[model samples]
Target: MLIENMKMAFSAIRINKMRSFLTMLGIIIGIGSVISIVSIGDTMRTMFADLYKEVGLTQAYISIGYWLDDVRQSDYFTLDDLERVKEVFGDEIAYIDSQSYVSADALYGRAKVKFDFQGIDYNYQDVQPVNIIYGRYLNEGDVKGRRKNVVMDVKSALQLFGVENAVGRTFRTTIYGSTDEYTVVGVYKKDLSPFQAMMMGQSDGGSAFIPYTLLTWPNDYFYAMRVYAKDDVNLDDFFGRLKVFIGRLKMRDAEDYYMATAVEEMGMMDSMMGGLSAAVGGIAAISLLVGGIGIMNIMLVSVTERTREIGIRKSLGARTKDIMIQFLTESALLSACGGMIGILLGSGLVSAVGAVLGVTAVVRPSVVLLAVGFSALVGIFFGMYPASKAAKKDPIEALRYE
Candidate 1:
């Protein structure tokens, strides 16, 4: 009986194909837009993960205290503190690396790189995910010897030297103090970062990497310390302990200087973004209600136009439930067809946008399935009133309409 009703539904749609298509337009647009917008979020997750991999770094780069505070009111960690941290938490944590940033932004001509020529210890590369594509990374011997070595990215090299092969070249940079010539030993390809204008907003993207003590004459004047933990929970706990350590060092309350954890911040960002996405999706989903209303509007009109036929069916002893089911089936089929088309169009739209934005298009199969299922539900929801009205129409009254 359902199959027979389906065939009749198709024929009815065929007879008024133009109106049926017009009625479906709202549903198609509403569903397609929701699917397409949400798909971008999926690609963003992949992009962030790949970025972490390319930085030649691990996920938890840890350092819980100030690099160096010039003022007598010292609220920072020192080499001794770093040593204490390593000695105490060495087994539980990952490698500890020292870091220093230039006091001012270094300008290689008009292009300014925000990252100071950072000073780092020997195991810096291992802790972080930086790749030395062209040249070698900084070594410990350079730090001990105070060698003036600089490593840079392809874009940074081009900005400063206007060429790709900047390795073995020398330039006088005012990085640490008195202008001194530092040899560019190796050039590297930088990891992808979303904050382009502030390239190293998350990191020092365009800036050069040098030995721990290479940037300055004495290594004691370092700016920041970076610690890369073994893994996720390891670093988290290390930071937890380090906060206690910093409190002791600060000679005051725990909040003297800000302590931040990337993992903590990132997780929070993910959770907040997840809520935001759901909220936006919920608002967008409301459009589906509008589309369903349109479907009901059209379906009710269809039933009214065929009122005489309905009366004839009732005269032939067709049960009210049977008539209601036929109309409901037609309404559902209309929405289902709209949903299928929306899925196709939404996928194409996401792919096209992804290409333009230089990101991958991620289509969730579940999203497709859910979209179609939701469309069927819309049919049932909005079709309720119209179906009931059609079922309640008296056969004698319906026949008089003709």
Candidate 2:
């Protein structure tokens, strides 16, 4: 009976092939738009999250700067803030990294290097994840003693000595007006940042790490504070505590304010992406609505064109429910066929767009199922009105109409 109903539906559509195809247009566009939007959003989110981890957005940044209502200045995050932070949330945090960037000339015996140097405290390795392959990094003693010790990246070392074993070699480094000769305690394996590897092919992040105490700043010295939490849950509590701790330090006011962390920024981005996905999905649903209307209208027209046939069936002892079921089945079959085509179109479109966007386009089973199920819902909903009208047709009137 189901097969027979489906064949009848196809016969009607076959008779009006152009009309049927045009009617399914709405469903096709709707599903396709939805897939494209979803794919793009998912791809971007995944790519950004991965890059964020690499750039340390997952870690907290405790930055300080002066602000006068709307005016902003770059005078912030002092060593005092570091001291206060350690006093408040020292146990929860694994490392306390304090660094500031400055451009200076470095002399390695005869090789000259003029690059932006970074000043780091003793506990950088504890708070940040790093692996040393050559020699030991600077310690608490180095930072406290204001020692002129420095660690060189492989590229920097190679540039100076043309080899990896450049440890124990002395280099003359200058910060501001002071020039001091320092021995290379270690050489790193890879240094990859664009600035760090300016001319090197193999360097990953090439920058020198020097002790924080060696830094000489004017009336103003600002440091970048990064705190890595012990765990995920601790991160949430840690931020709140840090805020309160800063408040106690009197750096919490709007004027002379400090931007705390990137957590809020990352969360905002995720929320925006999610909203975009929903908006796109909603727009796609409209096509299914149009497709449903097409199914309903075509089914009604088919019934009208076959009124005499319907009457004959009723006269031959066919019940009203039978007539209703047959027409409903036809409507469902039409939409089901349209859904299969739409699925393929949507999948292809998402794959192509993802490639163009330079991100991975992923389609889960749930998405496919959602599209199919929604299409079926359109059939059941729109098919009802037409099927009901056909079932209610009086056999005498249907027969007399022709």
RMSD to the hidden true structure, all candidates: 4.0, 5.8
lDDT of 2 by residue, 1-402 (tens): 778877877887688888777777766667667666776677767755654554455467665553345433333456666677777776677656554666777776666776556788877775444566678888888987878877777777787777887778887767777777877787776534442233233333336788876663543455456676655445666676675676557535533435455566667878999998887777777767877888888878888988988898899987999899888877776776677678788778878877665555787678777776777678778989988888898999988877
Clashes (N, CA, C under 3 Å) per candidate: 10, 11
List where candidate 2 sits over 4 angstroms from the true fold.
7-18, 46-58, 64-75, 98-220, 250-256, 356-360, 400-402
Give lDDT: candidate 2, residue 33. 71
Choose the strongest candidate by lDDT: 1
Q: In model 1, what lDDT does residue 296 have?
A: 96
Per-residue CA lDDT of model 1 for 1-402, tens digit only, reads 989999998898888889988888878887887788677666655555454444423333333235434434244455666677778767665665555666444455565545447677767666654667676876777766778887877777776677888888776667645677678878877555343223245454457777766543343533345666665545656677776765676575554445555566556756766787788787768878889999999988988998888888888988889888888888888888888888888899989878876666888998888989989888878777787778888999988886
- Model 1 per-residue lDDT at 357: 61
- Each candidate structure's TM-score, on Cα atoms with residue i matched to residue i, is 0.84, 0.71
lDDT of 1 at 189: 74
lDDT of candidates 1 onward, in order: 0.70, 0.70
Error of 1 at 384 (Å): 1.8
